[model samples]
Target: MSDLGALFYYLGIEVRQGKEALTLDQSTYASKLLEQSSMAECKPCVTPMEERLKLTKASTAAKIDATLYRSIVGGLRYLVHTRPDIAFAVGYVSRFMEDPRENH
Candidate 1:
């Protein structure tokens, strides 16, 4: 076995080790996720989700591609590891993966 030195990148996370702290970043992964969802130019929100927004399993909105929806949700789920601030938002979207709609 060989050592790879400091863990700069692993899986989709970028790691930085400083004298006082360790930092984990996922900007590249998040960007790729945005591109995959065809939202590369989406705006950033101070809040990951809208306040008081509610999503339901049943909806009148038209259906969207379930595969792509699931993929994006999965990426967001993974992102929650390094970006725990978005866990609630990711979990909110994950509920509709079975039948994602335009409103999802």
Candidate 2:
């Protein structure tokens, strides 16, 4: 293959090359996702989810836009590649994509 150039960014992931080691991150992608979810200014939590918190189908809770929810979930799934810490949360939320509710 032909040499393209120095690796900087690819598929929404940022690449940092150094003499000692290389680093890959999705900070920009994550920030954009936060902006998309309207939580850019939201406070950061120590944990992604509360321990032993159960999530059931919110039959009584108001329903959210399926398209938007799906889009957010999809983005989260993609982000999982660079952020495995959120895989559990993303997978949990993804379960409700078929019919996401406000409580979900």
Candidate 3:
């Protein structure tokens, strides 16, 4: 096939091509995810998770909607293709899918 042109976006990831490099990002996907999770207005943080933060199945914590948690995690997993920075955090939270708590 012939070269179509510089790719700008594909599969939820944005593409920016320059003379010496190409950049891929998922800001749109992330924004949509936040909206879907009802966290669109939440404050942004420099790090996905706190340093040395430990998460466990808090039996005493209030229960959350398993479906919502799973859906969010699933979206994050998909986003990993372009945003590996969040892989660890997403994977960590995904571990509690079966019984996610409010603190998860």
For all candidates in order, the CA lDDT equals 0.90, 0.90, 0.90
lDDT of 1 by residue, 1-104 (tens): 99889999999899999999999999999999999988999888899889999888778999988998898899899999998999998888888877899983
- Model 2: which ten-residue window has the lowest total lDDT? 51-60
lDDT of 3 at 43: 100
List candidate 2 stretches off by more than 4 Å: none
Tens digit of per-residue lDDT, candidate 2, span 1-104? 99998999999999999999998999999899999999999998868878887888757789998999999999999999988998999998888999889974
Error of 3 at 87 (Å): 1.9
Error of 3 at 14 (Å): 1.0
What is the alpha-carbon lDDT of model 3 when measured against the actual structure?
A: 0.90
lDDT of 1 at 17: 100
